[model samples]
Target: MKQGAQGSAATGAGDVPGSAVRVPPQSRGAADADVDVDVEVGRERYDAPGGVRGEHTHSETPLPRPRPAVQRASVRGQIVDALRTALVAGELRPGEVYSAPALGDRFGVSATPVREAMQQLALEGAVEVVPNRGFRVVERGRRELAELAEVRSLIEIPVMLRLARTVPAERWAELRPLVEASVRAAASGCRATYAEADRAFHRAVLALSGNEQLVQVAEDLHRRAQWPLVGGPGLRGRAELVADAAEHTALLDALVARDLDVVRALVGEHFRGAR
Candidate 1:
């Protein structure tokens, strides 16, 4: 994460020369910082219905903060993550081709990492490589999603059950960050954040098996299941997302307790609701 003078990049509709704007993690350019930027911060004044204007100033309104940019090889993973969230939210349409160079430019990074990320997406079956053109999103359907869920269940559940029985409670406790991320994302109704956090949680859960391939396959299936939800973010309301986020907490509970019956039930419910 890049740390410096944090501002909201409030570049009005061509109103200001250098106003703060959120960049994807570390995608901010020196050009953006070139102009004299004024970020309205700190004090907040609210006028009441029947009172004088600027009468009350209690606390500052929470403005959207700038997202940090990542580094080096991590940028590839970040790009993949950004693309996945965009895919889930239907920002990238099916059957339409997007070039690696263009996407790299869009992300303010090099084509190499963007291409590498696209290759990973291709492995996940989220996109297909189109010869000289680029990658196109695979049209995901209900049948495809169900099959992905079934495969994930077959691969992930048995190993997860074994880990629940064998792994120590402290190990499960280590996953609190991932769980908390999902909780925050769900509460904020941010699909991109929730999806990435959900990915991290499931991948962390499967990593206990100590099988790299197992974790990879489970993550791939997880991504596939999420991409085609037509109105995915809209459909998953705060309430539904909160309930979904609770599952991670509940799963952790069962794992720590070593409750085989509850673990098994939760595992089943996870896949069921995932579809």
Candidate 2:
């Protein structure tokens, strides 16, 4: 009976030796290699607050890393964008020869891309690519601008008037955001923003016609018309842009009210006054 008692004491409550102890793998010491792997993968570990010494409970989360610099894939596309902006801003003067190499140096790029982009602009009639020479910005003096205004008025006015009379009021309501953008651009005297807003407004208006061809023609002409007047704000100054933006507001107001007479008057004034 005494020997049995001793055996029971040795085997009871983990007193038998290492083979009798029971513990979960998680409660064991964590490996330092695991922490290093987590940190290397942009993961962070944070322990719970006010915990016991043996309680190594932790939470792991992904941390944000620094983003690498991005670059455009197409040098030609970049060259084209820069050339068009310069052309529209009138930075490239009309009736002057600008060589591809010179323009390439100005843009800090190679001549090949510049030449390629100028070829596209040549097709747009914004520039003329001369044989053996570089290129020349087409002279768009006041008369040309006036003629462009006349063409736009001819195409856009009638379509806008028709849509005002027929299109649903809700459809026209969508123009509010675009008009607001124009107002902001005008206030800032940013020619590029104003151009974008103006283009969006006119394109949206023409789209209601259901004639894709007409919309395409009008938008193309709009881009060309915008390219000529590159100084401060085209024709006048910042005030003109503000005034132009106001005309857009007044026109929308007339459209919502379904007042054809007012719309006609506003459209006529907008195109004529711009000229």
**Root-mean-square deviation of every model:** 17.0, 16.6
- Per-model CA lDDT versus the true structure: 0.73, 0.70
Cα misplacement distance, residue 275 of candidate 1 (Å)? 6.3
lDDT of 2 by residue, 1-275 (tens): 12121122222221223222211112333442112111122122322222212122244232355333232327778888788778655578778789999999999988888998898889889899777989988877667777888898899889998999898888889988988888998898766667778888888888989999999999878888777542333455578888988998998889988999999889878876552
Model 2 gets an lDDT of 0.70
**Candidate 2: segments with Cα more than 4 A from true spot:** 1-74, 229-234
Which pairs clash in the backbone of model 2?
A: none
lDDT of 1 by residue, 1-275 (tens): 21124444433222322343222222235653323222322223231222223211234343554443455568888998789878877688777899999998899998889899999989878899999999998876667767777788788788888998899999999998889989998898766677778889999988888899988878767877777554333555667778889998999999999998898888778777773
- Per-model TM against the reference: 0.64, 0.67
Question: What RMSD does model 2 have?
Answer: 16.6
Q: After best superposition, candidate 2 residue 69: deviation in angstroms? A: 23
